[model samples]
Target: MPESNTTLAIRVQGLEQKVPTLDGELQILQGVDLDVKSGESIAVTGPSGAGKSTLLSLLAGLDMASSGEIWLAGEPLHQMDEEQRANLRGRKVGFIFQSFMLVESLTALENVMLPMELAGAEDARTQAENMLQRVGLSHRLDHFPNQLSGGEQQRVAIARAFVTRPDILFADEPTGNLDQANSARVEDLLFQLNQEHHTTLVLVTHDLKLAERCVTRVQMVSGRLEAL
Candidate 1:
C-alpha cells in the first residue's frame, strides 16, 4: 500500500489502465497520481480522447486498474471486488454522468429511494423527499425520466447522487448537454449542494468556467496529469 495521504478524500498512486488492441496494448492511464481533499472541489480538464472519463472511472472503482491503487475515503478500492466495491460506493461514493443515468422506468422519487432502500436506511421516504426538494424538483417527484427536460433529469440525477450524503461525488461532463442558461442553473445548484453538505466534489469537465469554480484544477494530456 502507498503511504495514504491523510488529507485526501480520494487518492490514486501509480495508477494505470490498459486494453488489448489489435496492434498492441493501448494505455489509457500512465502512472497517474492524484489526491483530493475533503470538502474540496476539483475539476479534471482535458481534450477529447484524453482519458478524462477513464481516469474518473478508475478513481471511482467503476472499472479496474491494470496495476495501481485508489484510496477513497480511507478504504482501498483496488482491494474490493465488484460486489464489495458496489457496497462501498453506495456507502461512500456518488456519480453524476453526462447522460444523467436515471432509471427510465422509475419515477424521480423512486429513483432517489433506490439507494436508501438498498442501504435499508430508516426514514428513507423522508430523506428522499428532502433530497428531491433540495434539488428543486419537489413537484416532479412522480415524474419519470422521459417526462422531464434534460436539465430536470440532470437535477434528478444530482439529487440521487447526493441523497446518500456521500463523501465523494464524481461527475463526468455534468453540464455537457444543456444550454447556457440551464448549464448555469445546474452549475449553481452543484455549488449550493456542496455548501449544504460539505461533500467533496471531483468533477470532469470541458467547461472552463466550471473548472475555475473549483478550489483546484487538474489537467490531463496524453493520459498523464499536468499542472494547470
Candidate 2:
C-alpha cells in the first residue's frame, strides 16, 4: 500500500489497464498517477480512445484496473473485493454520464429515490423531492425519462446523482448531448452544487470550456497522463 494522504480524496499510482486482444495485450492506460485533494475539481480532457472514461470508472470503482493502486477517501480500492468496492461506492460515490442513464420506466422522483431506497434510507421520498426542487425539477417529478426532453432528462440525472450527496462525484461528458443553452445551465448547476456541498469532482470531458471551469486540468494522450 502506498502512503495514504489523509487530505486527498483520490490517489492513483502506477495505474494500468490492459485487455487481451488476438494480436496481443492492448494497453488502455499506462502508468497513470494522480492525486486529487478533497473538495477539488479536476477535469480530464482527451481525444477519443484516450482512456478518459476508463480512468473515471477506475476511480469510481465501476471498473477494475489490471495493475495499479487506487485509494478513495483513504480506502484502498484496488485491494477491496468486488462487493466491498460496491459497498464503498454506494456510500461515497456519485456519477453522471454523457447519455443521462436514467431508468426509462421510473419517474424523475423515483429515479432520484432509487439509490436512497437501495441504501435503506429512511427519508428517501422527502430527500428525492427536495433534491428535485433544488435542481428546478419539482414540476417534472412525475415525468418519465422518455417523456422529458434531452435537457430535462439530464436534469433528472443530475438530481439523481446529487441526491445522495456522496463525498465524490464523477461526471463523463455531462453536456455532450445538450445544446449550448442547456449545457451552460447544467454547467452552472454542477459547479454551484459542488461548491455548496464541497464534494470532490472528477470530470471526463472533450469540451475545453468545461475543462477550464475546473480547478485543475490534465490532458491524456495514448493512454498516458500529461500536464496541460
Candidate 3:
C-alpha cells in the first residue's frame, strides 16, 4: 500500500535546528518536512556533517529541535515540555545508538531487564532472557559489556532495545562496529522483530546494503532531505 494511505507514525514540518558556536549560530537542519507511516521503515543516509544524527535525535525525542513541528505517534513533541517528551518516549520509543550505550556495571541479562523493570513488568528477567536468547546471546547472559566482544555488545544493545517492543525504533549506525556475519544477523533480527510487532523503523546509516533494505530512503545534504 502507498504511504499516504496509511496512518502516519511520524510527522514533521518546517523542522530547523540551530546551535550557538564560537563564531555564531550553526544551522544543522533547515525546513525539513517528512512523514513516516505506521510500520514503515526509512533509512536516512548522508555525509558525516549533514546532520543525520541530529535529525534522529530530534525524531526520537532525545533532544529538542530549535524550531519546528514534530509529531511522534500523534504526540506533539514541540508542544510538550522535556518531562512530557521523556514520558512519551518511554512509552512508545526505542533507540539504539552507534556507541552501544550499555551500562558498564550491568551484565547482559541485567542490562536488558532494566527497561522492563522500570516499566513495572512482572516478568522482566524472563522476558529479557528470552530476548537475549533470540539474539543468540544465551551463553553470554552473565557477561559484562567489557567482557563481551564489540559484536556481542552490539547484540546486547539490540536485545535491550527490542525487549520492550516499542512502537517505533530509531537506530543510529546500528551495525557500524559489527563484522559481516554479525551485521547480517543483526539485520535479520531487526526486520524480524519489526515484522512481528509492526514497529516503525528509522535508522541513520552510511552502509549501502543496510540502507537498501529499508522500505524508503532519503539523503540529507546540508540539513535538507532529498528522496532517493
Candidate 4:
C-alpha cells in the first residue's frame, strides 16, 4: 500500500482534449481533475459524447491528452514516449471493455495467457489457468472466443485482465452488452475481484445499480466535471 499522503494511484489535473473536425475544433474534456486512491472504486457517469470513454482512454494511455497532467503510479503520462507509455501500461494497468475484446483466434486459456507471456513470467501457464478457473471458465479453456456465449467471452476477458495482477483496472461499460442475468453475474465477479485483490478501479458506466455501488460517483456534463 502507498503511504497515506501518497496513497493516490491515479491523478489528473487541468486536463484538456481537442480534435480538429470539419465543424471546428471539438473539445472533448476540459480542465478535468480527479484523484484516485489505492484500493478505491470510482464510477464516472455521463451522457454519450460527454467524454467519459475519451477520458478513460487518456488515463489508460491509449490516447494522449492535448494538455495538462496525468499521473499513474507516480509516472507522468504526458511526458512519456509511446514506448514508455506501453511499458507502464503493461506493468500496471488492466482493462475491461463493454465489447468483451477477446481475440477470436485464441482459446480461452490462450487469451488469458497472453499477458503473462508478454511479461515473460516463467509460471505463466499455471497462473493463467488458475485465473481462468477462478472466473468459472476452466472447462472452456480450449474453446475459442467465437464458440463461447457473450457471458463466457466476458469471463475470459476478465480472466485475461487479472492474469498479470494489475495495480489498477479501467473498465468501460463492462455490463453494457449483457442481459440482466449476465450483467448481475459479471457485477458480482468484478466486486469479488476488488475485495480479493484490493485493486484500484475506475469505471465509466451508465447502469444505475453499478454506478451507485462504487465508492464514489463522478458526473460529467458537456465535457466538464460536475458534482457527484
RMSD of 3: 2.4
| lDDT tens digits by residue: candidate 4, 68-120 | 89889778888999999999999999999999999888899999999999999
Sorted by TM-score (best first), the order is 2, 4, 1, 3
The parts of candidate 1 lying over 4 Å away from their true place are: 1-4
lDDT of all predictions: 0.91, 0.93, 0.93, 0.90
Which residue window of length 10 is worst by lDDT in model 4? 1-10
Q: Candidate 3: lDDT over CA atoms?
A: 0.93
Candidate 4 clashing pairs, residues 3+ apart or interchain: none
TM-score of the candidate numbered 1? 0.96
Worst 10 residues of 3 by lDDT: 1-10
Clashing pairs in 3: none
- Considering lDDT, which of the candidate structures 1 and 3 is the better prediction for this target? 3
Q: What lDDT tens digits, residue by residue, belong to model 1 across residues 1-228?
A: 345566678888899989999999999889899888889999999999999999999888889999988998888998989998888888898989999999999999999998899999998888889999988999999999999999999999898899989988999999999999889999998988887899999999999999999999989999999869
Using all chains and alpha carbons, the TM-scores for the candidates as numbered come to: 0.96, 0.97, 0.95, 0.97
Residues 51-150, model 3: lDDT tens digits: 9999999998889999989989887888988999999999999988878999999999999999999999999999999999998999999999999988
Which candidate, 2 or 3, would have the higher TM-score against the true structure?
2
Per-prediction backbone clash count: 0, 0, 0, 0
Query: What is the C-alpha local distance difference test score of candidate 4?
Result: 0.90
